[model samples]
Target: MLFAVEVAIALFVRDRFVRPYLGDVLAVVLVYCGLRAVLPLRVLPAAVLAFAIGALIEFGQAVNLLDLIGLRGNPVIAVVLGGSFEWLDFVAYAAGALLALAAERFIHR
Candidate 1:
């Protein structure tokens, strides 16, 4: 349902500014990590999995897999995915994953 909503919002909204807001993949990653932290899960493995998923999303975009799947290739998605070689998104993912790990520690305690 969430993925459907994201795709719908991305496709229906045609404004330039609205493009970026379609689907905040990075923020989603952060939220996913945050949830992991809140849950009783292994931090390292979960973080690694999040990082892998993020990387896959970016790489998949680079290869046009998303486009093939009917998802428009927007610059915003590219930007979020580290577009050619964006180190920032990776950093964001790492930060999110780490934050989730940290949050888990505090919450579990």
Candidate 2:
């Protein structure tokens, strides 16, 4: 599934473009989908929740919570929690959520 591919690229892909940006973009989509799977949120709410969660994670990175919790040394935790903060990643998450919302609207219309 798309989530699996995104996870693989996010973790394994070392290319500058795909690894840095695309992974962030797809992360919101994955988060949105996961939220929808458990919560009965509409597209907009799901996307919003995804963006909020992504922002929170970015904030966590800003504070070095991963390092505080000893997750920084683990590759999987490093990839999932992110090692450093980037403003661009917030933009990517918003863009990805917007795209997902638009697609959902188009499909459900």
Q: Candidates' TM-scores?
A: 0.52, 0.92
The sequence of per-residue lDDT tens digits that candidate 2 reaches over residues 1-81 is 977888789757899778777888888888998999999898788999999999999999999999789778898888888
Candidate topping lDDT = 2
Q: What is the Cα-based lDDT of residue 49 in candidate 2?
A: 93
Tens-place lDDT digits, model 1, residues 1-109: 5545555655575673433432444355464655465877566777777777776766775676655665456656544453343445556657656666676679889
Model 1's TM-score against the true structure: 0.52
Among all windows of ten consecutive residues in candidate 1, which has the lowest summed lDDT? 17-26
